[model samples]
Target: MSWRIGDYLDQSDLDVIVVGIDCNEGLKRLDEYGPWKSNEMSDVFSAERQSIGGEGKEYVEFIVHELKSMIDEMYRTLPGETSMAGSSMGGLISTYAACVHPHAFKRVASISSAYWFNQKEIEELIKESDLSNIERFYMDIGTKENTESMTILHT
Candidate 1:
């Protein structure tokens, strides 16, 4: 999927960067379920399906590398000052990136993450991940919505 860098640079000196990773499998599932709007971003990245993998974890790893390179080249941001944020499946990848590549980003904001992917695999990874240098972490989920039903997991 295409990564949409939001207009956060104009509002903060914190160098907030938002990356959108399209999850085709997730989007197709959403289409058959409900809320077609959820698939909009995924649709934009459909043409890039060949660039992504079938495994969610592998896809997340690719996104982490892409984001790090993009930020370093485009904004020249220092690893210690970079922050990443995303919603839903994006949140899952955001958290995965921070946990796996803690030095690439200092802060992570995950909104309604899909943590249920691979069952206990994610939890095991997060538990074993070294996050001593993570400056900040933000996680939130809507009480009105059943995230599990939406294939989202909030940890």
Candidate 2:
């Protein structure tokens, strides 16, 4: 997150309003169990009622456009300086937001993004997206993390 939402949200000239919706949980939410989870998986993963990080993209769009509009109307913001940041599922969505809606975000900080949720789908989306307006993007994960599963699938 950029900065906590409250009276201090717009206090600084370079301040950012870190916003988040009720995304319920993390690891499970982006993969199999979650709150803003998708109802169907991509063709690569079989079309089922499993959550596959699709809803995460939609949620980010809502925040980048609708929610940001509301915030700009209420705060003194530096136009074109908006950024999105999050950890885990939130991190995954933050990166997705920049990949799909580059114009809405100038920077993206995705800490430990769960790209393992739908590796093929997410990777394809990022590869197919227009990242011209995304000035910067940061993504990271622990070396000892669950990347083993993703690595196996790729093999």
Task: Judging by TM-score against the true structure, name the best candidate.
Answer: 2
Q: Give each model's whole-structure lDDT.
A: 0.59, 0.66
Clashes of 1: 0
Query: Which portions of model 2 show Cα errors greater than 4 Å?
Result: 1-14, 26-28, 31-53, 144-155
- TM-score for all models, in order of appearance: 0.60, 0.67
Write the residue-wise lDDT of candidate 2 on 12-128 in tens digits.
Answer: 564455655655454345642212344333333454444444456456656867889998888888658888877766676777777777888899988887655555667887889
- In terms of lDDT, model 2 sits at 0.66
lDDT by residue for model 1 (53-147), tens: 23444554555677567767887456567777777656766677787788877889888775543336557768999998889999998887564
The parts of candidate 1 lying over 4 Å away from their true place are: 1-54, 147-155
Model 2, residue pairs in steric clash: 28-33, 29-34
Q: How accurate locally is residue 4 in candidate 2, as Cα lDDT from 0 to 100?
A: 57
